[model samples]
Target: MALPWFVKRYPDLNFPVSFPPELLSHIIRDVCYNHDPRHPAFRRACCRMTLVSRAWQAVANSTPSLWRYLLVEYSTSQLHLAAFLRNSGEAPLFLCFRANAPIAADPDMVRQSLLESAVYISHTIRRWVAIDVELKDASVFHSVLLYLASLPSPPLRVLRLACAVPRHADRRSSFAYGFHGPTLRQLALDGAPPWSSPSPPTVALTRLSLHQCSWPNYSDFFEFVSLTSALRHLSIGTVRFAGTLPATVVHLPSLDHVDLLFGSNVDSIPVVASLFSRLTYPALLEVAISFNGYGSVSEFLRTPLAFRASSARLSGICSIDEDFADVYHRLFGVVTLDLSHGQRAMVSALSAEKSHALPLPSLSTLLLYMPNWRSLLDVISSRNDGQLAPLHLRCNYPEHLAVTHHLPHIADHDLESHHRVLSLVSSFSWIHPM
Candidate 1:
């Protein structure tokens, strides 16, 4: 087999190798797969492996899995693309096609090159396990979508499509395609095409993420999700909803993780309530919701959506009324609470005296980003009244020593002072720095 151009250029350079071909192949696979395929370092490392030694080159050439991840760009030469595809053999491929605004002298030629590459890969659609396409030009986007739409059914497991055009731009022509893959398990769409067809064979999907997508009505959104009964993770952000709210409540028995984000639009409040009230997921264990609009946090808390999660992250809340205290107390299943963003009102609500019951009685962990040490101290002391388990607190304070002095009331409890880091799980820590 012919070596890649980079490897052939350095044919005489060989490094000493002690490990067997099998072991070396295993090491190379681990290193290459761990890093993201879109990163330049990943491709560079994959090419560099062949130059390590003749034994390494032979092993790399023989291993089909090493070349299965193909990143095709506008500048990717035909030789490189063909070499990777040939060496990948019949292994399921993870394909990523990126077509950004070209800086080349001949912009039309660059786009044509991208279109040709898309057509070239169309023959291998049956072996595609995952495909991620990101395009900035509308014409190029339409061409790529056309190629994908003409392809036969693939064993695709994941599909992510992103369009960088402005929302006001005419995207109807570019996004007028439906995706259908029975084996698809993950789908992520960002300013991309909408699946308007009645049924597009997404029954096996376990994760769905939609960002900056608009629907004609609320029912359209619900109707799409009602199909993914086996979905485990659902994430929606900055999605626009219109028309009357749907009465149908979609039941997702297998869903466990949900992340929602609302932009600064007052109309979203009712839509948010409608969405939460409509969906019922019994297996849900974690939820993170952010509100960037003007509305009462209590309005969403009043929804029938089960807040029966072990951990919950709530942020972007501006204020809370006295009724919020009552609604907040209902989240009895939440053991860990994250109030790291604009949630000082929540701290006050938790600290407030209620003649009936304590807010979040089952809560044992608290993550706060409050600058006020006195209020933080007050809440900690109030919650540790011996009725509930000791609160494990993690927060950021300007003066660590000053906060430590004020913590004499609940000093015996598990207290952690974070300078710039909060110990919340990386996935739940979506709040940007203040």
Candidate 2:
């Protein structure tokens, strides 16, 4: 085989006629630092590189960035853990501790290991830029919380806590305390853990997600949102807000996306509406809402004036209770429209308009959920204008099999119609017998 141009030009640079040491060093550094820390591929690649040779092993061990993310478990040795942290040098650290792990077959050993790991991690808490912890027992979690309470605000940017204890666990009070990270921007809490202190300073978070987290009262929840002045994205799932929403509007100047979901509560719609009414987020661009409460979606829809007037986009609206007015149709400019589960009467209402104002001009995807073949054909026939952008039609009923027979002849089988038409027929059974 012929030598490459670089190898030929600099004979001394070639090490065993392959990768130069300088190039190899750069590649290894990039692989370890740039790859996603959570991906298994990262660990697999690093492990493979270490087996290459003693030179590669030395390089991997000396690279401070490679050991920055540590998973301290019961099986992890204190000596090895200390060496890993020391090798990480001054690089910002990401630490994860699972306090519920059992050590060997002994429960006493497990407790001792948990205590030892928490104490060791606390000593290095100032080096942590992000922390994720999982604690199941109330007593162990309370002890860990004390160490976390003493954490001095360093470069901590993300904190995620998952407590698997029961809702009535005594340690819940300790979990309610706030972290003291001056740079914390993202916080996620799951399984009923209170993530903030009693008097949390105004932290300008950009993203906040809460799943099944309980607050002391409605005021506390509102106060938390108010303090996050730089918040841009917020997600709430199955989190209940008690008492009436504050009348005062809280403005989030940078907010761009909001997602609210509800699983239980008869007053979900009103509660969601009340929350929306209290916020003024002029920069919002996308919104998603799911509620199984009393009243139709229209009630919640009417609450957010910003959603309608602002240039907000949605994935798709998928509820069909009653036909909404044309004004609602005019407000939406979504690229993908899923009206399959929506009321069929909406098509009639839209077709009856004399203006034919092209309500969904931006629409590129349309789904039809019809009772029979003829209804689907009727709706498709009503849209005679070929000026529409290319469309993808998805049919949800088996009876609409007849559609394929006549689809080729639609619009007189014109070239423009063929180019504009795209059909996606469902092979599965999502349609029920009416």
Candidate 3:
């Protein structure tokens, strides 16, 4: 057999004349695995690897892991899908089915293609370890759901399903019943029903992310949370809620990270406040809350549960009063605080003169987005006393540059000492424009 194309093309260059089949297989797997099967480059690379040499072809064909990831798209040929299924052997599969219609393609053709691929893949459902299905057509989405519902449960670890169709147009039934994967660890749903399953695969789930989903009432949501006792990280974005919440609080002992983002709905204030009041996660390490609505930070801070999170982010808060600051100081052991869309009132509250006790005493890192330097300097100066730890400030590019330029001109020796305590980090790209 001839050497690889690279070695043959560059004959003068020193190349290994022979490689242990195991070593060669590892090399090929690493190269192929780097690109997801959905990417055209992955298929091209796999084809080129087989064409490299007779030995390479044998190794590539024999390694079932190399052919385990199957991307089934509307444009994908049945022959290619069959080849992947055959080559994968008994290895666990990572299947991604994208039923999005190609540009200018007939809708009927797209649906037919998706149906065909779905049928082809259904035979090997038990071998699937992870399944990601993205469908744009409502009919196709429903069809796929029904097909999955009829199939026996797979040992799926990760399940991500996204539907682009509008909610109103889509049927209002629980799609969760279609999926029954007891081993599922991570589940992400976008524009899909959250939980309708009488027995969901929630017990094993560690991470759950819901975007643009609505709960019929708070009880369903709480019940869903109750089932997912092992959940460690929960993220809900722009979720719509209805009905009143129960007075009782739900305890999640294992939860460590909670992220909530409410869109431009003023009604979400009550939902946000209710979550803060209802959920108790003692081991929580990080909490991020953002809402584009007319809600006070004080209302949300009225929860009885005190979070020991070292890091906290509060965005879209236009003002923070001393009361809010006091509550915040009591609620969280926040070592790092991000106030991206903060106002002057918030800065004042952080630097408020408190003779008895300082607010946010544990705060060591402060991240702001394009904050007024004068107000920020005041914060640094006010907290510079021996009582609290020195502040580490991070700001956007323009503000950092401006501060660096003006720092030398400030002639006050005490202020210079304050500046010395600050470790100013200019996270240029990370801090986006408000």
Candidate 4:
């Protein structure tokens, strides 16, 4: 058979030519990364891409950059997760293992698998910057910690463990174990009392998030914070303590931002105000107080806390605890007030008198939710502050992450959120990352 017209015209080119290395790289990226269900390559062709040659497949299967943000939201069993972890030589930045199934495996196996996988993840932890892992069961926390302790590189920067974790499975195995998370900066632990101990997590963490937890009494809270001399940022949601926040908590020199999510029993107006007055957040920039997961907003008159706040954000200050509202107005320097969660929200007082209306000397951004077009427009158009360069208006939902272009006026951007999550789960063929 004769060559095609195009092939005949180009005499310099080989008859049945493959792409050059540079072109091949681009082509492979498109096929491996851009290909979808409808318009796709054959199944065999996908596998054949790897077998094209050893060196090519090596490039095809592994891209060091892609390992930075790995999300393991696998729908498979723990055993499968363990197997994959055992083989995954590349380190991932982020990994999420979400399995809500009831406890089905032996305690030791479950714990061991989690430990091994965590160890594997830790190997990459040094390479990548941040990690957000979710495990459903609390039984395997020891394993996770054990593995986390083994990482020799990259300090664990920010860690959010929303999934429950067992506190101590081997009590007799010596309760004197403690890991100094020199690299750990931000930590969010949402678990029960039965699952953890009162030994005090002594990580050099700055940002700490407490949600749906087991710190029932002041002693527990004290013990937890005792190890947090470097603690700065704290976010609390739904807790019923019999006593007040310890004096030591307020004494922490580094403590700054506190996101308080008040439970029905814990939401006291006077106490809320005292938390603001008593503590020291010299560099404290924002305060996002939510109630029952609902975001709220308030206009506060100039106060010590408000004046210092360059970008104070109070989202989900539910039902407007009248007592706290009084203190909220004094926030003078606040530049942003996010009230996206408008439903089930009641502010303490929003003065109709424009003159009396609390002014944010630095205020520039406002986030609000709207039902109709008119509301959206009104919210968008309401920002008169010339300094407010970018005003982001998002829907008002309790749990939903209000997506908008407006981020913190300050830097220290949340790169973790911007990272590509889905790429980690899929095959590594497409990645040409640096």
lDDT of 3 by residue, 99-161 (tens): 333222234544345444444444434333344445554344445444444443332332444
Off by over 4 Å in 2: 1-59, 62-65, 73-126, 134-152, 162-206, 211-215, 226-230, 262-264, 291-295, 305-323, 330-336, 339-378, 384-434
RMSD for each model, in Å, please? 11.8, 15.0, 13.7, 19.0
lDDT of 2 by residue, 1-434 (tens): 23323234444431322222222211222233445444665555545452213334443466545544443333434333333343444422444443333223333443345434434433444433243345544344334444343434332332433334344533323332222222222221111112233333223245665545454556656655555455666765555665766667776555666665554554656766776677776666666554423244455456674254333322224443344333345444443344543435445534454424544444444556555436545654445444433445555555444554544323322121234333553211111112
The runs of at least 3 residues in candidate 4 whose Cα sits more than 4 Å from the true structure, single-residue gaps closed, are: 1-111, 116-132, 137-159, 164-207, 222-233, 242-258, 263-282, 292-310, 315-326, 335-368, 371-434
**For this target, which candidate reaches the highest TM-score against the unseen true structure?**
1
Model 3, position 175: C-alpha lDDT score: 27
Give the per-residue lDDT of model 4 (tens digit) for 221-309.
Answer: 44555444566677655443566665654544454575665544444333445444555565766665555443333323233444555
How do the residues 1-434 of candidate 1 rate in per-residue lDDT, one tens digit apiece? 23334345534324422332221221222234334445565556555553213433443465544444444333545334433444444422444444333323333553345434444444334333344445554354434444444444432332444445355633432322222222221222211122232333323345666555566677666655555445677776666777877676666556677777666666665666666777666677776777753566666666655365545666677666667656755664554455656557666665555422444444456666666646765555433333434445565654533444443333243334356653322111111111
TM-score of each: 0.59, 0.52, 0.58, 0.45
**Candidate number with the higher TM-score (1 or 4):** 1
Best by lDDT, which number? 1
Ordered list by lDDT, greatest first:
1, 3, 2, 4
Order of models, best TM-score first: 1, 3, 2, 4
The lDDT values for all models are 0.48, 0.43, 0.47, 0.38
Pairs of residues at least 3 apart in sequence or in different chains that clash in candidate 3 = none
Error of 2 at 350 (Å): 7.4
Q: How many clashing residue pairs appear in each of the predictions shown? A: 0, 4, 0, 18
